[model samples]
Target chain A: MDIAILADAVERGERRAVARAITLVESARPEHRVQATELLETLARTGREAIRIGLSGTPGVGKSTFIESFGLMLVAQGLRVAVLAVDPSSKRTGGSILGDKTRMERLSRSPDAFIRPSPSQSHLGGVARRTREAVALCEAAGFDVVLIETVGVGQSETVVAELSDVFLLLLAPAGGDELQGVKRGIMEAADIILVNKADGDLKATAMRTCADYAGALRLLRRRPQDPDGFPKAMTVSALEISGLDRAWAEIRDLVDWRRAQGHWHARRAEQARHWFEEEVRQTLLAQLAQPKARSLMQSLSEQVADGQLTASRAAQDLFASLWPEMEQTKLPESLDATIDTP
Target chain B: MDIAILADAVERGERRAVARAITLVESARPEHRVQATELLETLARTGREAIRIGLSGTPGVGKSTFIESFGLMLVAQGLRVAVLAVDPSSKRTGGSILGDKTRMERLSRSPDAFIRPSPSQSHLGGVARRTREAVALCEAAGFDVVLIETVGVGQSETVVAELSDVFLLLLAPAGGDELQGVKRGIMEAADIILVNKADGDLKATAMRTCADYAGALRLLRRRPQDPDGFPKAMTVSALEISGLDRAWAEIRDLVDWRRAQGHWHARRAEQARHWFEEEVRQTLLAQLAQPKARSLMQSLSEQVADGQLTASRAAQDLFASLWPEMEQTKLPESLDATIDTP
Candidate 1:
C-alpha cells in the first residue's frame, strides 16, 4: 500500500489501480484510512475533474436499465463512465442490490465503463462519504462522467444530491391527479425527472405523468442555481432506449449554463464545505457516544419520558455530569446560543 | 422574580403569572434562564396536563379565523384555551404577525382564552424550544387545550409536528390534480388534512381536494401509531362555522383512541426524549461556536472549498489542531461510529 505508487497508477488510468484506490477509501480500518487520505491528497494534485450526476428512484423503477442505457450512450460517444451506488438499505439487510454490475450486463462488459455495487454501508453518511471519495478517484483515473446512484429511501437522495452537479429522478407513470408515484420530499431535489417505461401500453400514461410533474415542478419554488426551463420532467423509455440523447443534451445544457454563471464552481465548493462541517459535527458527537455517557443519556431519556424531569433539565444534568469542573453558568450555553453567519 | 410565589400563582391559573413565566423561559439572558428552569421544575410537580394540538397551514389559508371560531366554541363549552404561534419568519422580518391577538379579536377578549404572539427568535430550533416551554406554562396555568399554530414554511411545520399530540394540516382547495396546494413533505406529518375555505362557490373544489388527499393518504404507508380511518382528510369551513363541531368530534375521537392504545404517554415521552437529544447536540455545537474554534473551522472550510485539502483530511486536521494532546488514533472516532440502540 505504497500511496505514491497507487496514486500514480490511478492517475495513469490503470484499471487495477483504480479498483484498488476505491477499495482503500471504502476500508474502515484505521491504517487503511490513513493510507486512503494520503492517496486522495496525492490524487487531488492531479487536478482532474468529472461530471458528477446523481440519480435516484424507487425500488422497482428500472434504475439499472436506465443506467445501462445511459452509460452505453456515453461510452459510444468516447466518454469514460463510472457508476457508484449509495444504498443505505444494505446496512439493514446485510445485502446490497443496487449498483450490481450483473444487472447492467452490457455496460459492465464495456472497456470504457466501470460499475461498482453499493457498499454494504452501515449508514447514509458513511456510504455517501465513501462514494464521494470513489467519485474523486474516478476523476483522477480520467473518467469523464461519474454517475452516483442512490436508492430512493430515507434521506439518501438528499445526501447524494449534495455531492452531485445535477440530480435526476426516475419514475414510472403516475396516476392522474394521484401523483403519488414518487416519494415525498424528493421532487424538490430533482433537477430533471424522467418517466420511464414509456413505450407500448404505458406510453400515453407516461406522457401524462411527465406533464403532471412538470406542472408541479413549475409551481414549486424555483432554485436560484438552475437555469431557465430546468427542474423539468420528460418521458424516457430505457427499454426502447429512446429519449436518452435528449436527456443527455439537457444535462449538458444545464452543466454548461451553471459553469457560465459561475454556479458550477460555487456549488462544488459549497458541497465540500458542507461535508467538512458534517464531519466536524460527527466528531463532536463521538464524545457523547462513549459508554458511560450513553448509559447516562439513556437513563435521562427514560426519566424525561416518565415525566420525572423536563427535557431541558435532563440535558443540563447530563452536561453537569460530563463536566463537573466546568462552571454551572456554562452548562446551558444554548440559552444564549447565537448563530454567527460566515 | 419570586419562584415560589410565581409557581403558586401559575398553579392557581393566574393570568399575569402565566405570561410572566413564558417571558422568563423565552428570555436569552442567563439569569432569567436559571429562574425559568426552577419555575418549570416546580410546575412539573403539579402534574397538570393539557391536550396539545399542532396546526399548520400556508399563510392566507384562514388559520386565524379557524382558531378564533374553534377557540370560541371550546370556551362556550366551558373549556379554557391557549393559542400560541411558532413563527420563524419573525426572526428575519423583525415583525410578528401569526399569533397577533388582534387577528382573533373575539377570542383575545374572552377571559377563558389566552393568545400569545410568535416570539421574534433568531432561528427555528430556539423558537420551537421556547414555544415548548410556553406550552408547559399554559398547561400549568390550567388551560384545557393548547393550540400551537405554525405558519407553513420550510421545516417549521415538521418541528411543530414533533411536539403535537394530534397534528392537523390545513389546506386550501386544489386544482383537478396538481395537489400543489400544500407543502411537499408536510402531508405525511399530518394526522388530519382539513380543506379550509369549504364554504363559498369554492366548496365543490374543496370537496374534490379532500377526496384527492384521501386517496393519497391511503397510498401512504400506515403508521403503526395510528388506528383505522386515521390520517384521513376532511373539509371544514371556519368562515361559515359549519364544520367546526364535526372537526372537533373527529379530533376527540382520534385523541381518545390514541390514549386508549397507550400512544398518548408513549408519544409524549418520545417527544421529550427528542428535545433532550436535540438540546445535547446544540450544547455540543456550542463548543465549536467559540471564537477561536470558529476561526479554525472557517479556515478549514475555505481550504476544503479551494481543494487544498479533501473534506475528510481537513476534518482530521481540525481534530489534531483542536486537541494536540489527544492520540491521533482516538480522534477519528466516527470512522467506527456505531448506532447504539437503547
Candidate 2:
C-alpha cells in the first residue's frame, strides 16, 4: 500500500517490482491507484530520460518483425530497449492476453529488451493512458528506449501519438493509389512514414508509393516543433532487416532535431495538457454515471423525447431540482467557480 | 414557427419546402432543432406507409446509383420514393466537395422521387437525431419506399439500420479474397448482402463473391427474426440497372416476413430505446462542456496529473462537492434509480 516504497524499489532497477508497481497503478481498486499515483509522482521527480517512439500500421504489416530488428539494433548499441506493443483485440473481454510477450518472441528473450503487451480495455483511451504510465515505469526500470506499437485502425494512431515523442506510421507498398484509403487527418499527424515490405515483388511499388507520399507531404504544413523535419517516407524490408540501422539513425536524428529546436519538451508539455483534459473528461463522465445522476438524466431524456419540454430547459430544471445537494460541500474554488458559472 | 403548419405543408406534398424544413431540423441551432423536432412529431402522427430500406457500403460502391435505380423502379410502379443519403465528410465541416445531388443526376430530376443528402456531423453516431426527424417528414410528405444510403466506413451501418425496416450491405467483388476485408462483426449485422458492380469483367468475380457470402451466412446463427427468411446474397449492376428488381423483391419479401412475425415493430421499438439513450448521452456530454464546468474539470485534471489525487477519488470528490446544489432542486428519485438499472 505504501507507494513511496514501491517508488524506491522501482528507482533501484528492480524490474519485477517496477512491473508490479505499474500493475498497482492500473488497478481498479480505489486505494491502490492513490498509492500508485504517489509512486508515479516520485518517479516523475527522478526525470527518466527515455526515448519513447510510437509505431503503428495495418495488421500483417510485420510490425513485430520491424520492432524486433529495430530493437536488436538498439541493444547492439549498448542501450536497453523496452517495447509496449498494444493489441486492441487482446482484451475484448476486459482481460489482458499478454500476447505481445509471445509475438515478440525473440525480443522478449533478449536480456536488454523488456516487452509488455498491454490489454486494450473497454476504452481504447484507457489502454493508452495505462500504456503511458507503463512507459514511465519502464524508464524507472532503467530502459533508455521505449517503442509503443498500436493497431492501425480507428483512433489508435491519435491515442498512441499522445504518449510518444516521435510518431512513425508504417505502410505497405500497395501502390500510390491505395494511399487514398488512409484518412488525411491521421496522415497529417505522422512525423515519419515507412513503406514496409519493400523487398521482393513489392520493391518497385514501395519506391513509387514512397515517392508519392513524399510529394503529398509537401501539400501539408510542416510540423510546429521541427521546422526542419520533413515527413520522410522510406522503404524497408523487416524480414530481410536491411534498413534497421538507417531507421534507427533517422529516429535519433529526429529526436536530436526536436530537442535542439526545443520542440521535444514543448510537445511533451502539450501532451501533458492533453492527458489532463482527457483524464478530467473521462473521470467526470464516469461520475455522471453514478446511479442517482443517471436516473435523473434518463427521466429528463423521456420528458424531452415525449415533447413535454426542451433539453436545455430540462437540464435547467434538473440543476434546479438538484441544487441543494450540489451546494453541500465547498468544492475547490476553480471547480466551484466553473460549476457556479451559468 | 408553428410545427403544425409545417406538417400541413409537408402533408400537402410541398417537396422543396419540406426539404428546406428538414434541413432546418438538422441545423445545430437550438431553436431550429426545437422547431424541426416539433414539426417531425406532428408529422409522425399522420405518417404514410413507406417501405423504408437502408443501403450501406464502402465508398465507390455506387450507393447513389443503386438508390437512384431503385427509386426509379418504385416511381415506375406509380409510387413516390424518397432517398436520404448521408455523406460523412460533409457533416463534419458542413461542406461537400463530391456532391451526391450531382452524382444522382437523373434521380434529382424525377418528379416522383425526392433525394436529400445529409453531411456527417461531429457526433460519433453516423445518423443525426434530425435525420430520424427528417425520415418522419418524408413519410408525411407522401413518399413511399424511403431508401437511406449511408457511407460504407465506420459504424454508419448500425446507425442507418435504426431508422429503416430492412438493412442491406453492398460489397464489391474484391479479388479472390473479397470477404477477407469485410469485417465479421459488420457482416453479422447485415440482413442482406448485395455484390454491386456485377457486370463486364467483374461479373464472374461478383457471382463467386456472392456464393462465398452465402456460404459464410450458413455458418452463422439464423437471424433472431425471420426464421423462414433466407439470408440471400445477390449480384447486381447498379450502373447497368440490372438485377435491382430482384434485389428489391427480396427486400420486400424480407420486410413482409418480418411483419408477419411481428418483428418489424419490435425492431423499431428497440431503435426508439437506443435513440433515447443516445440523446441523453449527447445532452449530458454537452452540459459538461459548459464554460464553468470545463474550467473546473481543467483545474481538477491538473491536480490529478500532479499526483495530488487519483481519478476515482477526484470524481467522487466532484460529485460529493456538487451534491448540495443538485439536492436543492428537489428532482424525483426516479432519475438516479432509472440510471442504475440501464
lDDT of each: 0.82, 0.69
Q: Calculate DockQ per candidate and list them.
A: 0.31, 0.06
Query: For residue B19, what is the lDDT in candidate 2?
Result: 73
Worst 10 residues of 2 chain B by lDDT: B333-342
The 10-residue segment with the lowest total lDDT in model 1 chain B: B333-342
Q: Which regions of candidate 1 deviate over 4 angstroms?
A: A59-61, A91-99, A171-261, A323-342, B91-99, B171-180, B183-237, B240-246, B249-257, B323-342
Q: True interface contacts reproduced by each model, as a fraction? A: 0.40, 0.05
Worst 10 residues of 2 chain A by lDDT: A333-342
Error of 1 at B226 (Å): 4.8
Encode model 2's per-residue lDDT on A73-166: one tens digit a residue.
7888899988886655554432343456667777778888877656434352455557767887888778899898888656677788888998
Considering chain A alone, report the TM-score of candidate 1 relative to the true chain A.
0.87
Give TM per candidate: 0.85, 0.65
Candidate 1, B1-342: lDDT as tens digits: 578888998888877677778877877666776778888999998788899999998877899999999999999999999998887776532244433877899998999998888765544267667888999999999999999999966667877898789899988887964685565568888999999999989899999999999988998888977889989999999999978899889889989999999998889989998988887777666667666668999999999999999988998888787755333332232334221111
Top lDDT model? 1
